[model samples]
Target chain A: MALCNYYRKRKLMDNLVGWWIRLMVFLVVALPLFITASLLSKSWLILGHISLPELLFSSVWRPLAGEFGFWPFIISSLWVTFIGLSLTAPVCLLSAIFLTYYGSRRLLGFMQPIIDILAGIPSVIYGVWGILVIVPAVGKYLAPMLGYESPGFSIMAGGIVLSVMLIPFVLNILIEIFRTVQHDLLDASLSLGASKWQTIKHVVLRKSFAGMISAFGLGLSRAFGETIAVLMVVGNVVGVPENLFQPGYPLPALIANNYGEMLSIPMFDSALMFAALLLMVVVVVFNMISRRTIIYLESRQ
Target chain B: MAMETTKLSIQNLNLWFGKQKILNNINIDIPENKVTVILGPSGCGKTTLMKTMNRLVDLQGGARTSGKIILDGEDILNTRRDIALVRQKMGLLSQRPTPLPMSIFNNVAYGLRLKGIRGRKKLTPLVEKHLIEANLWDEVRDRLHDPASRLSIGQQQRLCLARGLAVDPEIILADEPTSALDPISASVIENQFFKLKENYTILLVTHIMRQARRIADKVVFMYLGEVIEQADVHEFFNNPKQKMTRDYLQGAFY
Candidate 1:
């Protein structure tokens, strides 16, 4: 009779634990989706009337005349993101590869903690640095060389600051992933008469391509969502930029510059919400694509 | 076997890893076009000796060496010799089969490509030839473009063998190559080694006495960072020179 009671109690505890695990898994996936869905629904009423193509492609966005074209801000966002990525990718990747494969022990030990500290720095500080240092340098030297006026508040400035901001984020992740490439694989490459460069190129980089892509995705997401540094330099102009030298307004900057006065205008709050929704979607899509690519590559392996 | 030319000669080789002696005054003359198996217990530095031949040992941090490793009348221990060039003359198979992250064809073609061989037409035949030589072409012929990692562990080992062969190395260094494989795969690798000995100098490291008996043409028995015996495979098994060799062969204690 006692043994039967013990068995019954054990079965009940197992059932309860299983239920708890199931609930936790469900919440992990569902919670973020639910919150984002609720936010999106809140903006749906006004967003329903505005054609997405107009918001995406049209350049003019005048609030008093009831014109709401978001092309300029969205395009600027994409422009700055691409510019930052283009600047940051090669530098961080090369640094990461060198540190992981060829750097001396003392150098590697010194650089790793420095990179960690860089990653932990606040965004607002980067903005201050850009204003006090980069802006003046560009205005005094780079702009004059390029035959441009001394405004210094341009897309190039934003991209330059953003790239510096993203270096540590991308490099730290890449170094770790590069380190995880199997030691035996490295030995195999070296033994096969491959030079250090060849080994890194054909083996280590190829093996970690998916992880690198994800790092890029994360960097892109951060660049897109970054507000303070970009707001300080992007000139706050809602227009299409002709070149890197021209001042422009990206989405995050637009939202930051407008969210305070959103309540005064009709449909303004909904439009800002829509912008937030678009930002969320773009980030989510980039992250999902990276995740799926990694999964696909892993499955192949 | 009147007299075989020494393909690689190690004289008074000593290695230290931060005050801990790993290889102590080792001396061995590896003959040309022969399968020389180094048999020893775990931690006997068999793998270390093989790696040292290919100059892969110095890659380890704090690994210090004092030795004269002469290959083809040149001292390979000299830093002036190109490491890539040194490694190119010797192919290595690690304990686990590590296929490069690429197609089966590319894995074999990697070394060839590094030597500036280009164009699909040129590469395809050489890849096929090496694959055939490694005895893996028939199984992988249909899936040449597929990822090399998709194959079984045994097949991967064969693929790695094919990759090593494509480099045209005169010497092949295999460190416990078949240790990770099943019996059938092990036999396949062993058979390849037997055939490959006619063209290439094969240096195999293994603790398995049965395997040493099966494939070794020349045997070098090592124990505790020292070589106890160097003899013909038949004589060594039938008549071991040293007490340690006898004890090791008798399965007295590993």
Candidate 2:
């Protein structure tokens, strides 16, 4: 009777544990779907008030006047993210290669903790640094050097700051990816009379192509949705920017800046929720595409 | 055998990794156009000694060596000597066949392109010739554009052999080339070496006594980072000068 009772208790414990694990897995898988559903339902109120094209393509964002077009904000977000990525990709890739192939072990060890610390710093702190350093440099020197006259807060300043923020994140991933290329592959190339630089270019870079794409994809998503640091330096002007030097406002800055006062304006809460929905959709689509590309590349190998 | 010309001469080679001696006072004369086998148990520094010839040991941190490795009457160990040129004249096959992350044809053509050869017309024939020389042409000619990783393990080794041969080296340094292959693949590589030794000097490293007897024209036995015996293959097996060599031949210990 004791053995029978022991078996019954063990079986009950196993089933309970199994159900708990299944619940956790279900919650994780459903999280994105739940978020999307809530965002869609909230944004539906604004969609009923205005046509989708008018809301998306119009540049005039007068909340009290009941006009909310997102064209300028969308364009500004794309420009800042593009400029940031263009600046970060080359430097991070080359630095990773150097660290893997040429940098001494002591140097790599010293650099790793520095990169980690940089990644750990909050975005608000980055915003403060951007205001103190990058904004002044752009206003005082860079604009005048290029024969332009303006206050420092502009798309270029925001891009510079965002690029700085992205360096550690992207660099960490690139270094890991480059290191994953097998050492024997390097030895094989070297033994074939290829120069070190040649081996890096042909073998290491070629092998890690998919990983590089994913790293850049992640960097793009992060830069696109960044709010505080970009808002501080981007001038937050409600207009389409013509050049890197022009002041403009992006989507995340829009949502973050107006969320407090959204309740007072007509249909403003729905508009801000719609902005959040747009941000979520774009990031999700980009991540899905990059993941598919990675799977394809791995399958080909 | 007629008077054999030395293709490579190692004189008083000593190597230390942070004060731990890995190779000590090694000397050998590797004859031209012959298969010379270096037989030893694991951790005997036979692989390290081979790496020193190609200067791959330089990649290891804190590895210091003092020696003269003369190849074709030139002291390759001289600091001013172009390491690329030294490596180009000698092809090395590692224990496992490592194909570059590229197509089969590109793997063979890579070394040729490094020498400044360009265009498909020029590369196509040379690639084909080397593949044929490595005895891999018939199997892979139709799938030259496929990724090299898709090939069987045996085929990959042959592709690596073709890649090495395409560099047009005078010497081939194979460090246990067949150790990772099946018996059929092993015999295939051995047969290729027998035919290849007529034109290029081959230095093979193996611990298998039967393999050494099958392919070696001359044998150099190593033990604990030192050369214990050097002789013709028959004499080295029949009458080893050292007790360790005799014991190793009789399978006393690996």
Candidate 3:
């Protein structure tokens, strides 16, 4: 009778613990999604009769006059993200290859800690560095060399600073991914008389292609969402940039710069919320695509 | 019987990994167009010795070697010649099969493509030929373009064998090529070694005494990083010169 009572208490405890776990999991999973849906619904209702497609397609962004076209901001964001990705991914990939395949242990050990430190640095610090260093360098030398007048702030400066921020971030991830390429595979390629370059190109790169793409996606999302550093160097002008040296503004900077005046301006709150929704969608889409590609690659593996 | 000619000669080869001596004063004359199996217990530096022959040992960090590995009268230890060029003259099969992350056709074609062979017209027949030689063509001919990793472990090993042969190396270094395979696959690879000996000088490292007995024309018996006995297969087993070799053949190595 005593043993039966002990067993019944244990079963009751297990049921209680199981119920707690399910509730905890549900709260964790549903909280963010619930918040996002509620926010999106509020913005959609506030948007009222203003069709989203018109706002996206139109180039005018005069929120003061009730005109809320965000096409220029969208374009600028995409343009900067493109420039950052194009510059960062290849350079980071090559550096990763160099570190993993050709670097000596001592050199790698020294570089690794430095890379970790660089990755941990704040974005605002990068902004200050860009203003003090990159802007002046571009204004004094790079602009003149290219026969362009410099205002000391341009999309090019933003991209350069952003690339510097992203290289170590992407490189750290890629190096780990490349390291996962089995040593036996490398030996097989080498034993087949493949040079180091050939082996890296054909075997190592191919094996880690999905992971590398995911790394690029991370860089892309970060580039899209980055505000403070880009704001300091990107000139904060809301227009489609004509060239690399021209002033431009991205979506994150747009929202950050204008969020203070949102309550006073008519329909501006809804516009900015819509923009936030757009950014969220983009990040979600990129993450989804990368996750799907990684799953596919792993399935093949 | 035809007179055996030396294809590779190792003279007093010594290898160190960090501070530990892995291969100590090794000397061997590997005959051309024959299967020479290096039989020893695990961790006996048998794999290290085969890797040293191809200079694959040099790829390891903190690995240092002294003495010479002469291949066709060229000292492979010398750094003057291109490592890839030297490596191209020999092929190596690892213990586990690692197919390149590509289709079966591409895996075999990889080496040929690197050596400047291109165009589907040229690659298709050559890939098929090497696949046939590796004895994997009949099963995979229908799925040549499928991912190489889709094949079973045994088929992958044979595919790796085909990939190795695609380079047209004069010497084949196999490090326990069948250790990871089941009995059927092991027999298939053993049969491949027998057929391959007609054209390539095969250097195989295996701890399985029976495998060495079945396929070796010449045997190199290693113990504690030193070769204890090396002789013709029959002589080594029936009349071992060293007591160590006799004890090893009789399953005394622990």
Look at candidate 2 and tell me the lDDT of residue A256: 91
Question: CA lDDT of A128 in candidate 1?
Answer: 90
lDDT, ranked from best to worst: 2, 1, 3
Interface RMSD of each: 1.1, 1.0, 1.2
Please tell me how candidate 2 rates in CAPRI terms: medium
Give the Å shift of residue A32 in candidate 3: 3.3
DockQ of each model against the real complex?
0.80, 0.74, 0.74
Clashing pairs in 3: none
Model 1: per-residue lDDT, tens digit, A189-261? 8887888898999899999988998899899999999999988977778788887777889988888888878
lDDT of 1 by residue, B19-113 (tens): 99999899999999999999999999998888888888878888888989999998897759779888988999989999999989999999888
Docking class of 1: medium
**Model 2, runs deviating above 4 Å:** A1-14
Candidate 1 segments whose C-alpha is farther than 4 A from its true place: A1-12, A296-301
DockQ for candidate 3, C-alpha atoms: 0.74
Measured with DockQ on alpha carbons, how good is candidate 2?
Answer: 0.74
Clashes of each: 0, 0, 0
Q: List the residue pairs that clash in candidate 1.
A: none
Error of 3 at A173 (Å): 0.8
